[model samples]
Target: MARKRGREGRFVSTVEGAEFFKVYLPQFSSHQIRIPPDFTKNFRRALNEKVILKNKDGKTWYVEVKETPEGVFLKDGWPRFVDYHGLKVGEFLVFRYNGSYSFLVQIFGTNGCKKEKFGPQNIATHVKSEVESDNDDSSSVDRSKLFKRFEEEEEDNNNEFPKRPSFVSPPSRRKMLKIPEEVMNNENVHLEAEVNLRNAEGKEWPVNIYTMLNGPTFLGRGLCAFQRDNNVGPKDCCKFIFGNQTTIDVKILRH
Candidate 1:
């Protein structure tokens, strides 16, 4: 029998110059950055509780998800983490959530260089500044409205994630494949997951995996985004990891 799988989610954002440049921990209740609605909905942990943040190099940090009127933020270790990583404005940060409390953070330099680890050795010591309450300009974004939109959309659609197209036959017309009885007899599994596809250059690209019962077992979203960024093609093979807290690894055979 095949192994059971779990779900995954991701949120990629470019560091805004105004928001990420300076240490904002002093102004907030604890050091944290406002998280997206999807993040909060998926995790649903209580405010002021701790969550584990693992970096690409396997380093871990315990950070609290503090809920505020504006939204939720990752507090506690954020400032030191940011400083160590030398996080700069305009750099892209890819946050891959494991459909639970933990998140894997990958950093890309402004020039798209991959950074495996961030150490405090190279970073200058950050002196905690006086709490400047007025500097908290982030309060302008009304998170209640944003949260409402997500709630309404979830209620109306009843689908957690968006589904995209499945594997298509190439123009040459591939031969029909047979479905094994074991797979056919397997119970239907539908949930939010992710596929980590590696390009020719070996860069890890994560696409949203939406599983279904019929026709094809796995359908993926954000494939186009990965293709666009990585220039992947039908001839190139990829690897897929599916699950939430636990995961199963599979490979996509190229046509």
Candidate 2:
């Protein structure tokens, strides 16, 4: 059973068990991921040589576990799991361990929204192609260059870190903020009713979306209170990160 949270609409497992979250950081989290020591302490003994990682869709991957003095790390087959998910830096993952060796994993993008799972066949084909390409590489220098280029391109196109939609508030629009046309067209935001604008400090202000006679949408009600509380001023640019339909994280830049 899954319970939904209001902030990002992420599903939380109702089953009581040991769970831990990790933010994917390529520096150390790419090849291997260490389970938190506190979470590992829940286990009576060492983990099995292999454990099952099941996604919400019921797909499972068998990953090798390595016990070390530092902590327990998911190794070996872990890279295939990462590649299959197309996991990127800053993405969050929650691992809930059942009493058995199986763990249910849920992945979330940087926007704080749960990521959609790709079909198994598609990911398998992609990973297979990647592995074949890697094996065919003869020149180390060429392979390294190609890898660097791939990383750069991946970073540029990563949806998890997409450029935030922003607009500079003019003096006349102090009481209301217009939603960008591109933002409305984007599925990341659902402005049918209202959205809560969250700041860096985690403070939130509920603002309503108003449609004008001309067909444009603007954040009207409750925006004044948000501006007053945040000290928003003219010429200040506000960047909006749509976490989901109900929540948007806001960042302000002073002019």
Candidate 3:
């Protein structure tokens, strides 16, 4: 499987899963299609969920559309996916790819009339914001209090007293999954890590991390639940081996 992703991921041994978190654009002469107000509204309406494919024998695919009209261009629609939506003035549709194993799509095209690459860094901010927003909505708590509390904690962390030079704090119970540096950049790399998580005790915790690949280019990233920790063992042991991407700050948005 590793060798397979390497070949498909352009010899990259890092990226896993063919476009796990990415939208797979087709290997074609990708051009742009100006947005029609109708399309803009409809594009997002069907993101990452099964939609009717253009020419499918009933095989629907998922799509990640970026509705852009201003700023860093690729400020990425997944962000103001709602605010910046305007499909009337003329938009571009690069190309599209759909997933077979899961409902996923990778779109290839331009943002604000310019070419764009579907990379991890490109979507990280949008993804992070979306995730936080989703969690917040679920809690629907006092938004003001949440922000104030978060700010206070942030400030306090910044004020933590320095420890003695000779004193080293114990390692975190979390483990970071090993991903080869080569994997982070290979556009075609597809990776899937079967993470096993165990808490400080000795109870088995479920873990699974998935990342997708673009064409034969980008070292993309995927959806992983390791913010939960990557030690797959007992529920109490603080030691683990194959885990990456740790969650430093945790917020109980729903509690």
| Candidate of highest TM-score | 2
TM-score (all chains, Cα) for each model: 0.36, 0.41, 0.22
Residue range with the least summed lDDT across 10 consecutive positions in model 1: 169-178
Writing each residue's lDDT as its tens digit, candidate 2 over 1-255 gives 443332233223334577899999989988899988776555423444687888886766667878878888998667657755768899999998874568899999899999885333324443344334533442232424433443465476573334544333322234445566777777656653456889879899876555443445666556778877888775454556776766777766555
Q: Please list the residue runs of candidate 2 whose C-alpha ends up more than 4 Å from where it truly belongs after superposition.
A: 1-16, 44-48, 119-255
Instruction: Report the Cα lDDT for candidate 2.
Output: 0.63
In the range 1-255, model 3's lDDT, one tens digit per residue, is 332232223222222233222222322112222333432221223222222222111222222333345311122212222111212223333323232313233333335443233333344444445544544443433435644554565477793322211111112222222233444454543333222343334344333332323422211122124333432222211212222332111222121
- The parts of candidate 1 lying over 4 Å away from their true place are 1-30, 124-255
Q: In candidate 2, which residue pairs clash?
A: none
Alpha-carbon local distance difference test for all models? 0.44, 0.63, 0.29
Candidate 2: TM-score?
0.41
